[model samples]
Target: MTSENLIKYTQLFINNEFVDSVNKKTFPTLNPASGQKIADVAEAEKEDVNKAVDAAKAAFSRNSEWRKLDASARGRLINKLADLLERDITQLAKLETLDNGKPVGDSEFDIQCSIDTLRYYAGYSDKIHGNTIPADGDCISLTRKEPVGVVGQIIPWNYPIMMLAWKWGPALAAGCTMVLKPAEQTPLTALAVAALAREAGFPKGVINVVPGFGPTAGVPLALHNDVNKIAFTGSTEVGKQIMAYSGQSNLKRVSLELGGKSPLVIFNDANLDEAVEIAHGAIFNNHGQNCCAGSRTFVQSGIYDAFVKKAVEKATNRKVGDPFGDGVQQGPQIDKASLDKILRLVESGKREGAKLETGGAQIGNNGYFVQPTVFSNVTDDMTIAKEEIFGPVQCILKFETLGEVIERANNTQYGLASGIITKDINTALVFAQSVQAGSVWVNCYDYITPQTPFGGYKMSGIGREMGAESLEGYLETKTISIKMPGKL
Candidate 1:
């Protein structure tokens, strides 16, 4: 590897130290751009997971430094980590791009978002408060919010560093110690950040990162009896498995941000150019690996044909090449398996009678790349419309009216995000209210801010990830009662 893109910190980070796994096992993390092995990451199995959890549990104990630290002091430490991350943004972003195959610009944005997330939660550390209730004159009643002890967080590969911030920010802000499992495919960035957490003077075991496969390390962390909570961002299937493991084990508090087949609606009143641009970004960003990607594009009949033409042109012109290359908007899929799955789903779309308007084949001889594929004349029954393809593929379906489109959009097992492009405020409001997704964007798509709460409804996952609402998930409510003397 070049000096600018060298891999660093491949060992498991436990108790604020980089250490070898119990078995000393390692897995090759690939550079998806060249389909080459970038580095061998230390693999954490059940034994290593147990060690990390034990450390986290101890750190979270009342007598430990982490728990004994004042809430504002904890916030300061998290802010310090954010400052450290800001200083190393370039290096961390490069590592993310090298390992995850997203464009460098995208990686930089992710790092900035993560830093902002840390800062946001730092502000909340001191503000997390309890309430005093006026009860019967004879009694004093109050409720306090306390951290949920040790937490196990499993973050997905698509947005590795950002997802880490989503899970780590609140858990730490609430005074909880955690054992984090970065996705095996993209563990480099998470490992690098653990060093920063140590540098920021976080107590040993306050933040631990164990890199390994889901079954080996992830399941153990999720099922660990000492872990007070499990926060995960991944596929719906795995989210379900984690929930089941929670039930089978300690019934830990579980929070999930799962999969989505989000819809982007284009009403006739929308600016054709703007709608086309937004829709292209909604699905094609991150190679469509986003859990809340707007994969389903619904267009009103008045602009149906026009929208398809412009969308096809945009997808065809999108550059699919090396993520590090200048002006390359689209990058390779995460790995060969993901690329193959995307291609298979594309074929199914064609078989199911959706018109393949443009690119649907893999690109280049090396690495895992797929052309930005688009399909027109898609019906609700098509596999591409129903399933979370999680690739750079967009399915465009025509609708006649608002009521019909709302029904069609809500008819899915996933309800993570939805968007509408319309100039009419009434139309946007109606669509936003009627849509079943957790987040609804008007005249925009995929506009995420750290201040806004993000999550989903129905099968899309159980709880919120960002904003004040997220802090509630990492905390527990305890009610206190004291009887007063009759002399009062």
Candidate 2:
């Protein structure tokens, strides 16, 4: 399953089958570690988008088998899909690594997590409930949850397979037909998963994938009047554009898990080993491309110098090489634009007076690789501390008190996730309660589960992604009242 042995062609998935793009246009998905195209994916045009949307709409409308099926039946179908995914994890992981330049180990974990997520949501399918209300008269009142209809889901390139599972799981469990659009950089795994889904007995047109550029296909999907909802996981800037399109076209319900500049605060009383381990896991995991990654780290002033030194040493020791290697811990960014963006942000940090601790330069000549970078003496106002670099770069800032660190951590345009490393229960409780971020980790960072609800606050995006609450996003609440013959 290595890139050398991997195949190069993948067709679009529409109407529960592999189909060619209407225009027969194709785009090469490059391996960021080697700067070489590993696969060619169908480039979905506007007509392809229309076909996918039409398929999803038909599946969602009345008389369609997908919408006619009960939640339990949907859950069984998705669980079958999860089983198929588990059987092919190895091959799928290799494809993801080759297509996205993430290490094979990380890709395996991501694919496994994707399976768990689908199963988790599938188990919750029948758990979606409605409530009855008491009335003053001899009347009945109740509320029910109904599917939001056709959903246009867009997944990011960093963790394509996992994010797709995150969106598709709940959307499908809620009985909403979906039109998925994976990032153009890496679409092989998504297409492969769609094939497995078809084999799992999902009805035709229940799930469709259209792969194309953002402007042409993505924008059209977001602007389609028939699309009942838009769910996106990407940058904040692009999230804004999608929101605008949703507003202008259909005013559809939109759920976004956008960009994050999450903070990891280490108190003086924290466990040094645990702090260091969690700090590394927070930013270095997935090459720091995670939206909920604790990218902005703040340490107590008393332990600032020692913490920065140890963190830099640990970060610099990260293995950056071929993503296909088994022991490689870090790999290249997703593409050339991502690499250039990380480099430019590093330059901005240097120009703005942050001290480069270690590993700031680019690595290798053939790929879009960046050395694991760490910056010290980063104030809260610096660009490195404020903006998300989204590479394996850590910005270590110093803080004095718990109150001060909480305030500084909350002072950001993004509120996706934050972490606290401290042994004191009172301090951890206060910080967790006071932090504005959606998720707060106590001694761990970048921990995700299909049971825990994941999302953000303020500019970080809207709605929740996991847990029972996620089912709500795909459903609309309707109130029903019935009058009795006799008055109260």
The candidate that wins on lDDT is: 1
- Per-residue error for 19 in candidate 1, Å, reads 0.8
Could you report the Cα RMSD, in angstroms, for every candidate shown?
1.0, 1.5
- For model 2, residues 31-71, the per-residue Cα lDDT tens digits are 88888877678999889999999999988889989877888
> lDDT of all predictions, in order shown?
0.93, 0.89
What ranges in model 1 sit over 4 Å off?
Answer: 1-5
Per-residue lDDT of model 1, residues 1-488, tens digit only = 24244576999999989999998899999988888888888999999999999899889888999888899998999999999999999888888999999999999999999999999999999999899999877789999999999999999999999999999999999999999999989999999999999999999898999999999999999999999899999999999999999999999999999999999999999999999999999999999999999999999999999999999999999998888889989888999999999999999999999999998998987989999999999999999999999999999999999999999999999899999999999999999999999999998888888789899998999999898999999999999999987864
Clashing pairs counted in every model = 0, 0
Model 1: lDDT to the true structure: 0.93
The residue pairs that clash in candidate 2, if any, are none
TM-score of each candidate structure, all chains considered together: 0.99, 0.97
Backbone clashes (count) for model 1: 0
